[model samples]
Target: MKLALILNVIDPKIGGVMIMGDRGTGKSTTIRAIADLLPKIEVVEDDVFNSHISDYELMGESIKEKIDKGQNINSILIKVPMIDLPLGATEDRVCGTIDIEKALTEGIKTFEPGLLAKANRGILYVDEVNLLDDHLVDILLDSAASGWNTVEREGISIRHPARFVLVGSGNPEEGELRPQLLDRFGMHAEIRTVKQPSLRVQIVEQRSKFDSNPYECLNEFEAEQEKLKRSIIEAQSILSNVSIDYDLRVKISEVCGELDVDGLRGDIVTNRAAKAFAAYNSKDQVEISDIKQVIALCLRHRLRKDPLETIDSGFKVKKVFENIFGSS
Candidate 1:
């Protein structure tokens, strides 16, 4: 819920939450629930790219048809495409290549879209992100940053808007993500296995009940999910009006500078996230408490490593905020 709220505030269009944690911590379960809880997005029919919002890239022939006939464009609400980037996927499969079947049968240079295109305007999930090939990882990072995909290999030179929230999950113990890729994640969270026996038992029982009677279980949670979704929609509506005072902005910059966080992205994302939180709570402006709650998620992964000892990064971040801006 916190991650979703943050995303809605930060970058409702392309912001994403990358979850890092150990296995069996309900990472995938939580992602699926969030996807289910979101309102449906409309898309063009049978377009794997979910290309409906813009018509800039449509084929010349189709564009002419729509222009000449003056046909009313129809939009259909489908489940937001939550595409999973599987491990062991090849570059050809991910960024797409020429259509082998088309070339052999029709003798044409038809460009086939890949997973990235299919994930446009939606969430692209990469489980075991740390294990992804370096080349594939580069492609993902480039697409996420630029919001566009250009494939020049295999006699194809197609460019399409490939904007989407990139969500990745991995156990940090297994492998580490490259610093370049790490910076692309707007918010990061670590989930741990529930230690309390009763809580663990409750989780298992809930899963069993969900599996046994999926429909009934979903029905029971449907009202709660709907209320949550309404909250998100309401938050989005008010996000534009939320104010960030100049004093708070200076404090945000100072804290990031104090922590030695690289670049200005941290400052920008932090300010935007705080305003989003304020809007979520129907406040006219952000408060110090909002910054404190948001700074941990924004700056935790951006801090420079200290060799002397282990650091409680979250606590350290909160402490910095408290010292600079006073506790909320």
Candidate 2:
């Protein structure tokens, strides 16, 4: 799960990760903690949408207007916005509504930016996502794909940058998302509660220590966190230069085809994830080990399920990968 999060941060083009696990598994805690490790992003000053200062395509209409009028745009560095989307949120709340009162009184079209606006260029986390309304889920996936959200109401149309890594977690016991929707996520991480008593005790003790003295615990991990942050930033800088072998690419697709995956998304995400893993390890060339590490995470959830088949999806991916690439 941590690997998936790190890879997505390195290359948001890899899409985002879906985490499914049992209750009380700390999925939410881990996802939120990752925000702390990330480097701050630069945004146009006081811009609600976290618009990039120079990238016209990433800017909201207000920021673009400033650029068009040759106004000096002020910028500030801020932590990447991490917005939590609640289950009961309405369409207006998730996708910003037209400020009806402001529009009528001032005779101007104004948008009340919602969660999507705040989530631009950042992470949007939805806990219990499987229970979330399917309509809202569709809206989020659409925006994440298009990198923009359009809100049209009462003859007024508003569009803004909504690019964000969409991370979601759910308990499978409660329910499961439709296969079609689940396949949209770049990778799926399935976690289980620790079965061994010793490990469980250790985990409990660690949490207890943190609860007893949060500051002291944080201080202990500060150096390690900073080291990881530096690695992630460096990986991002060198990701474009990372190269995957041609044979490896063909084999990655072959594995996907052999699994009878529904679409090419599985193949594409696997390639990007392998490269991201190579970059994460500070290697310019992707190795078989890198692909081996990420291929299952990228393709497991994409496989077409057979009611009669007993094989695990992840195991099947590995088996195919081994067949195509040969055990190295």
Candidate 3:
């Protein structure tokens, strides 16, 4: 269910998710699996940041001049990047800066791509996100929301595409993001340790088998993985055709209103998420069930009117949604 939302950001721009939980859960594992099961992206060859061809046309003078006159800018397919952001990374490491060699040798300023640049149009998975530097987290939220990364240093400024799914996971026991940063995420999900006896045993057995023979495990799930990837690709292809009905939109609006959501983000995110789910399911339009399916994800991180009290935000969201849209 959560993976569907991450894939949604790839095509529908539904925005990123914040995952909070204890350690040793499947949070990171599931994210990696989703990344591996996804399709490769076609990017302009030699584009250090894997920027799209359209974006390359409007690139800076230095990058534009690098290409030969009348030279066809060819495209190449590469695996979609899955970048990991360690909590200890600095701003210079995450946002990059002017290339020192270019400035010294040619006396020209060139922007060096950073982790965020490499994560462009892909996934930026941050482990222990709550423990990250506040400044770094601010930059991530800003870049993810604005879809552009701009760095300024030594009187040189560079801007480029920074659009991507900002998947952040952290152990809540260690710490929590400030309300402001929490609200910045489009969605939030809680990862819990598996407690089902049968499921726990199955998980251990699967891990044992994979450890004994990794290649065998990959082959075993290759077909299923390929099929899931195809569904994502096909959904992205026909995403434009999937629309939300007027009544459903109103229901979404009403639900948000009843919840006393912060600004219009809850409403907007819910709409986008619902549409993405519909498209993923090969539906031409969104249904009430689709809206209900994503309402919790969309509203879980937002603030409520009774901020002084501690309440389960997910339950509140479900309550509001069910009240308006009826039980599923």
| Alpha-carbon RMSD, each predicted model | 3.0, 1.2, 2.4
- What would the per-residue lDDT of candidate 3 be over residues 185-206, giving only the tens digit for each residue? 8888887888899999999999
Spell out the clash pairs found in candidate 1.
none
Q: 1-328 in candidate 2: lDDT tens per residue?
A: 9999999999988889999999998999999988997999999998889999999878998888889999999999999889999999999999999987787799899888999999999999999999999999999999998899999988889999999999999999999899989999999999999899999999999999999999999999999999999999999999999998899898888898898998899989999999999999999999999999999999999987888999988898999889888888
**lDDT tens per residue, model 1, 16-70:** 6668888888788777656665667766665556766446543223433565687
TM-scores vs. true structure, each candidate: 0.88, 0.97, 0.91
| Per-candidate total of colliding backbone pairs | 0, 0, 0
Q: Indicate which candidate wins on lDDT.
A: 2
* Residue 48 error, candidate 1, Å: 3.2
- Compared with the true structure, the alpha-carbon lDDT of candidate 1 equals 0.76
Worst 10 residues of 3 by lDDT: 57-66
Tell me the spans in candidate 1 whose CA falls farther than 4 Å from its real position.
1-10, 53-72, 100-109
Instruction: State the C-alpha lDDT per candidate.
Output: 0.76, 0.93, 0.80
- Top-TM-score candidate index: 2
Candidate 1, residue 44: how far the Cα is off, in Å: 2.3
Worst 10 residues of 1 by lDDT: 56-65
